[model samples]
Target: MNVATDFPLREYNTFGMDVTCARFVQIDSADEIPKMADLFDTPHYILGGGSNTLFTDYYNGTILHPAFGGIEMASQSTPTSEGTSSSSVLLRVAAGEPWENLTNYCREHSLYGLENLTGIPGLVGSAPVQNIGAYGVEVKDCIEKVEGYYTDTMQPFCLTSDDCHFGYRDSIFKHELKGRCFITHVWFRLSPQPRFTLTYKALAQALEGREPTLDSVAETVLAIRNSKLPDITQIGCAGSFFKNPVVDQAQHAALLNRFPDLVAYPTGDGMMKLAAGQLIEKAGWKGRREGDAGIYPKQALVIVNYGNAKPEEICNVYRQVIADVKDLFQVTLTPEVNII
Candidate 1:
């Protein structure tokens, strides 16, 4: 592990915010983590691909980047390790592995669970932190377990799926026990025979009367996302900056009177999932730019950093948009991207 001071983070995050880390260390192997941990006295933030994080200002503490990378196949057995005639597979990936790379590997290997999350950018470890999702699939659906080093105990342990408590772009890692665990690796169970899911409208439309193949689903999702979202290489953006707000049936009905054509999904528990994009667009925020920050014209949910914008400017637009949506529709929108 090599420690450096004042590291430039312009290219580290997809959002393209120019923030500097006071102390930066890259750990490429699990064996190196303990020594690195011993060197840092202050609290640290673990960064993977940096796709999901928003740096509002320069980090004050050490920034630990888990650069470890590898994948292994482990025997997939129940928690009890009972033997079975049918065999499942476990994909063990290092924390720093690019999420897209893992998805591609799964596709190439005929693994079934990650087809719907084709275009999402980030690292594998960060996926569980947010329970990252798209096109009717979420990371929690396939994650068998997460292995990490607990800062408090200074020991490594595995967390079962239920332990993660994944819920709508959130998990135990993000709340209740934030920054307590340094995830070193993750394991997932995938199917050789795919069980395809096409619940999202845009994905369904893209497929449009075709049989759902793994490649087809992935291709369609990629195409759909590429058409709307700005390329991270060109402009900085964390896809779908805010999550769709979930409201009770009564609130949905009340909002329906104001905007009858608003798109919504029934949660089956008497709550409705209203599209934040539609709300933002209706409020006239789409494609609107102030300095280097702007809302993507095609995707109201995506806030873009057009050029050399400060992180605070990006957040200002985010705050303004959320506030407007709340004032107009009486629903509070929560950001999907992690803000630091």
Candidate 2:
């Protein structure tokens, strides 16, 4: 266990906010989990890649960060009596492994199913917590199980996919089990066979008429994400600040009639997911900034810090965006990023 006091967190978080923690602890191995159980008695925060977290103020408590890293094929089942083996392979990935690095590794090794999630920032551990999704694929679809240590019990546990109770950008980890456990690794069930999912319009257009390979699909998703999201390294920002609002059929019809050009996607069972970016753009918030915090010019879904913007200023801008969207469309937008 590596420990520090009054540690700066600008480098740890993608937002590049210069906040300090009272106690910052880094655990590089799973064995270290038990040693820090005592620290859990007080308020503590478990940090992953810091991609989806907004440090709103100085964290007065301890920050536990996992640095464990490794990836390998965990197990394989035998062929069935019909002479066809199960095409799936289970991969055990460490909690601290970079999400993009895992996807790239899968693509290079001919592993399928992770192509649609390329270029998403953060660590593998947080994927299940957020149920990260893009281009019509959610990480929950590929997750077989999540392994973690229960903070309350100080015991390790494994939860299967069904046990996770995953939903749109959510899991038990974000609700019932929030702050009760710390993920140590994830088991992903991937395929060796070629499978392509091109449901999103932009992704389909990018590969128009071209044969989609793992490399091609992954590269296309990366391109699409890059075109819209600001490079966090260059400018501090969380990729998407708000979750797309999903409404019932009647509400959807009412909004559609008002805004003929509204971009909405069917989420089945009489629910429609409206594009938060489109709503923000229509409300005249795109390319708009106040002080040093503002919305990204290209994508209204993103909120960025130009430089040295305080967390309160960013929150103010966020509040205004939500208020404006609600006032104009009668739809409320919820934040996807965790505001700490």
Candidate 3:
């Protein structure tokens, strides 16, 4: 429970940028937050798994770590005329539980719904905040409730599925209400009755036109991720540095005319999803390196901090990519990783 000053953060984030936190505190349980809150006396950022974040510069305030862990299942059922049969089971996960670990746990338990989220490196608490998604499935689809405390008021609250306001890798927790609450736990509704979702192109192709089974989907996703994303252990990188921009139909058509080979997914809401990676590669940025920062060869959307790169160097590359994409496509690429 020691709050250190000017702490080195190179080992804390996936980017491996050597930045120093002005203040740092780590908590292992929710009961400790109240006491820590008193010590904060100032604004702070909650550190989870630190997979989807970039330390552009050192923090000026306290950086708290939510280290809680544990997972529990509860039997849930609804009233019926026939009988009280279990409808769904609630899996309660601590805020600090690694997201990938939770996905693997569900896979091992024969529980469906978390398979598509495989290989996403983050924490249970941060998942809902970003509405983390991959292969056509977002975490919001499986979340039942999110329990957290109001940082300002120091009051605890519970948010149901709808309250999360999840949409396209975003949630209320991220915007409109950012930093207002500190997520402590998350509850998800997973099914033992296999209802797999493997609709994405990569997944479908991996399955070879077969039905979506939990095991197959999970395995396919893991393989795909491993092949695409850089190994954080070897190379410092935050996967998918930029978010795929969703452009309107008019813009999509304009881009299609300019680049006929452009690939996109219909949002079914007068918008089309364009892959940021494809755009980066099309812009001839793939495998490009500048100093210690570089665009990943396999996935241009990722920006890697190769070997002892400073935080500013990584931020420079991000700015360059955004500027280049805007100049070429008239589309602004937004970063998915939290740049702090």
* Predicted model with the maximum lDDT: 2
Per-residue lDDT tens digits for candidate 1, residues 10-57, read 878889888898988888787776555564457688888888889999
The local distance difference test score of model 2 is 0.92
| lDDT assessment of candidate 1 | 0.87
Ordered by lDDT, highest first, the candidates read 2, 1, 3
Candidate 3, after superposition: displacement of residue 159 in Å? 0.7
- Per-model TM against the reference: 0.94, 0.97, 0.94
lDDT of each: 0.87, 0.92, 0.86
Better of 2 and 3 by TM-score: 2
lDDT of residue 270 for candidate 2: 80
Using TM-score as the measure, the top candidate is: 2
Ranking by TM-score: 2, 3, 1
Candidate 2 collision pairs? none
Pairs with backbone N, CA or C atoms under 3 Å apart (clashes), candidate 3: none
Model 1 poorest ten-residue lDDT run: 77-86
Pairs clashing in candidate 1?
A: none
**What is the Å distance of residue 92 in model 2 from its true position?**
0.5
lDDT of 1 at 36: 53
Q: What is the C-alpha RMSD of each candidate to the true structure, in Å?
A: 2.7, 1.3, 1.9
TM-score of 3: 0.94
